[model samples]
Target: MKAIRIDEFVRDLATLSPKDVPSPKPKGPRDIGVQITHAALTHVDMLYAQGLHQNNGRHVKPPFILGNEFAGIVTSAPPSSSLRPGTRVFGATLGSFAEHIYADENGLREVPKQWTNAEACAVGASGAISWGSLVSVANLKRGETALILGASGGLGVMAVQIAKALGAKVIAVVGDEEKARMIKSTGADGVVDYHEKDWENKVKAMTEDGQGVHVVYDAIGAVESGLRCLRYRGRLVIVGFAAREGKMENIQANRILLKSAMVHGYRFGEDGRQDPTRTEEVWNGFMDLVVKESIKPIIYKKNYVGLESVSQALIDLGKHTVWGRAIVRINEEAERELKARL
Candidate 1:
């Protein structure tokens, strides 16, 4: 089997070499062996490559595979999982930068017939993330206002659609004028460029009372300066430190106390990696939105370069340079053609 693996933490994404590894073999009752057709690359992979998340024991420790989200066809499954062979699907399984991956059936979702492989790829991580990071953490309600940073990336794009679907007004922040327009395309009420010197102030000026948005989805935790953009009693959800690495948000506790504000931290892996209930909530919410045509994701380009491309993709993501979810696609033309049929 062809796969990409890291031998050591290196500065270069091109450094991790691709090689042939033994195909994955299935284990006991809960597993499903998937002939992975698409794998989405995210910043977590780059952080893992830089050895930033040593806390996770599952990381590649030299000659190890990395990746968590993939869309594929199931080749085998345990009856207990209720998944059948040859089912078109998408799912999350850590270490999926390979040709074949084995995932617990519950972690895998049956992709809808109308959806393409690229679209289904968004279901696992991007779709699930929108619910977990927005609904679970911020606890938003209809007619409320949300401010989302990094709103043009994989997760941000999904967040925008989710917010609008839930009937909330969204003020999204992007990297530049082009992304500003892109975020607006998702029905966001307003969009701001974080690169602008007064982006936070602009955000404050756009929402009610100039206090701040009712909910702040700060997935790019590199945005402590955006604190001034929060409303009184507004909740801020921190999903990752995309903007700031190893740097404290250093918010004034007094401010949070005075304004009755809330900061909710979320890690995608915490309790939801294999937890049936949390996984179910996230997936169910996503499917309902998709079926309603409320939260349509922008299926960015899917790359056919497998294994070896994972590392470079990760580094590109970490540096804010990836165009979209750079996926290791098993069959390039076939996947695109499937998506086109949708």
Candidate 2:
């Protein structure tokens, strides 16, 4: 099996490449063998490559395959499992940038009939994170105004669309005019250029009566401004600290006290592991929105093909050049077949 193996963390992503590795086999009764067709590139992939992500040296160590989300065809499953041989599925797990992977039943889901493998792969982690932060944690309600920071990144774009599908007025805060325009096209009610002076005030003004947003979804470390954009008793969901390069940000207690706000730190994978029932509930809700609202994960315009392209894809993501999800096509034949059916 060919896989993007990380022998050790390196400072240069370009140094990382694919190699022939042993194919994964099912380790448990519920584990399913999957032939990976496509995988999504994320910031976390970059972090893992550099040994900067929390999961590195903790949940997983060096000398492992990289990548977390993938769409694949099941090669084997337990007789009692709903998934059988040749079932198309998408899921999140380590070692996705490979020809094959073995994942737990709880981590996998059947790909929607109408979706291509590339699209399904792109949605796995980003969709879960967005759904978990907004719907499960914040309880974002319809008709409410929600402000999304880092609105043009992979997770950010998914969050924007999911928030809109939930019938919330979405204010997307981005870095530039082009990003702002792109976010608007994805159903954001308004787009704010964070480069503008007093952008936080501008975000508040976009909400009804200038009262501020009902919820602030922060994927970047803009804690101070996020607090300012929140209305009384508003919820602030912290998804990541992309802007600060993974460094934690300090929030002022006074701001929370004054507004009676609630702040939530969201780690989608960890959350799902801790509470499988709630994770299922969140996933069901997310799929419902994806199907009913015709919500699709936005793929970047650039195409990354094959396991060898994984390094460049991760580099592009680190440079912040990818507007939406960066996807790498793994099994070209499988992807072609999946697209033909669609």
TM-score versus the correct structure, for each prediction: 0.90, 0.95
- Best candidate (score: TM-score): 2
For model 1, what is the C-alpha lDDT against the true structure?
A: 0.74
Error of 1 at 105 (Å): 1.1
Clashes of 2: 0
State model 2's lDDT: 0.87
| lDDT for each residue of candidate 2 in 59-118, tens digit (9 for 90 to 100) | 878888999899999899998899987789999989999999999999999988778788
User: How good is model 1 by TM-score?
Assistant: 0.90
lDDT of 1 by residue, 160-244 (tens): 8899888999998888776677678888899887778977889889976777888888777754554578877878887766666
The per-model lDDT (C-alpha) reads: 0.74, 0.87
